[model samples]
Target: MLVVIGRIGRAHGIRGELAVDLRTDEPERRFAPGSSVVCAGRSLTVKAARPHSGKLLVTFDQVADRTAAEHLRGQVIEADVDPAELPEDDDAFYDHQLIGLRVARRDGAHVGEVTGVLHLPAHDTLAIDAEGREILVPFVAALVPEVDIERRVLVVADVPGLLDPDAAETVTPPEGR
Candidate 1:
């Protein structure tokens, strides 16, 4: 299956090279030269990919010059990857596997469904859509105790004020009329 590995940022220079914010842990291995990547729902061949500063400088076969590279800014880059090739450390879970899972409390109370995964600057968070309201819960072991991908169930630990929106609000006394 194809997984998002990076995003094409603004054009770096006038040589068709674009700045890429890599989302994967192994950027150098994934964005190697001659690698096939899918961007903007279209397959593109990577003509050259090299590290620059903290991000990657990439050039695609079809993209030429600054104008062409600028058009691809903010576009997500994906590539076909095997799930088994990923790291299997404890407390680590694949975002794709978490999608469509049923989220519930430790007491077996249904909370919501895992609609999507958000890759925040700090860490990954599970996007749960419960009764039309979106709830972002961190995928830490302290918050999420159990995750059964085969059964599509996730057991979340004690997370106060997560379900009630009003719990997050502060009440103020009304001014005397």
Candidate 2:
């Protein structure tokens, strides 16, 4: 299985270091020294990585100069991982694990299905297909209380306007107009 770990930004310096926008939470493992990742159909080995101005500065053994790093700009870095490998944190879940899971409310009423997971800068969002509409829900404990993988269901809070904005309660207009 291949997972997107980061995206290559502009070349940082003349030494072939490039700024990377992280897509995965496990940056220490993904961009660690000696780690190998695929980019633009080429396998590259990480020589070093460090946090720089909210982005990661990474040097690849394959990229020897600024021109080589420039060639990789805007390319996505993907890591080949084991299908059975799981995150160390029990609360963490891979995108594949959450996708296709049935979404339900706190009352166990069927709501929709998780179609995708968006890895935003702040957090991950669950893209749900409900009644032909796409609803984005923040993957948080307050909103999504339970995730029963055994049952293949994700229990979301029964908050109005969450599942359906039009269904939310609204006050009626006064009798004047």
Candidate 3:
């Protein structure tokens, strides 16, 4: 399986260094020297990398000079990972691990099945397919308290209107004269 680690930004200098917009939490491990990544259907080896501003300036052995780096701009960098590999953090889960999992309420009521995982600027969200309808739920500890991979179930908090919009209480305005 392949996971996105970063996106190639603009060329940093006259050299082959390119700024990278991080997508992964562990940048150090993913962008370390001698590490390998795939971009634009080509494998690239990390020659050097360093933190610049808020992004990482990385030089790839396959790219030479600013022209080569410019050609890689806007390309996404992906790394191959084992399917059975789990994140080091217990609370963290890969998108593949969550997809296809059965989503249910705390009371064991079935809500939906996870279709996809969206990585937004704020946080990760779960895209659920509920009876042919799409429902997006934030993947947070408060909302998603438990994720049982062995059982293939994701327990969601019973927040009003979260699972069912019609279940939420409606406010009625006072009668006018």
lDDT of 3 by residue, 1-177 (tens): 888778888998898999998878788898899999999998999999999899899999989899999998888888888999887777777788999999999989999999998765556789999999998899999999999998999999988888788887788888992
Winner of 2 and 3 under lDDT: 2
Give the Cα error of residue 103 in candidate 2, in Å.
Answer: 0.5
lDDT of each: 0.81, 0.90, 0.89
Per-residue alpha-carbon lDDT of candidate 2 for residues 46-108, written as tens digits (9 for 90 to 100): 999999999999999989999999999888888998878886777878788899999999888
Model 1 regions more than 4 Å off: 83-93, 106-109, 118-125, 138-152, 155-161, 169-177
Show the colliding residue pairs in model 3. none
lDDT of 1 by residue, 1-177 (tens): 888778888898898999988777767667888888899888888888888898889988889799988889888888888876553455555677788899898889888899998765555788898878998888778888799877889987755566665676566889993
Top candidate, metric lDDT: 2
Q: What lDDT is obtained when candidate 3 is compared to the true structure?
A: 0.89
Please list the Cα RMSD from the true structure of every candidate, rounded to 1 decimal place: 3.9, 4.0, 4.2
Count clashes in each candidate, considering only residues at least 3 apart in sequence or on different chains: 0, 0, 0
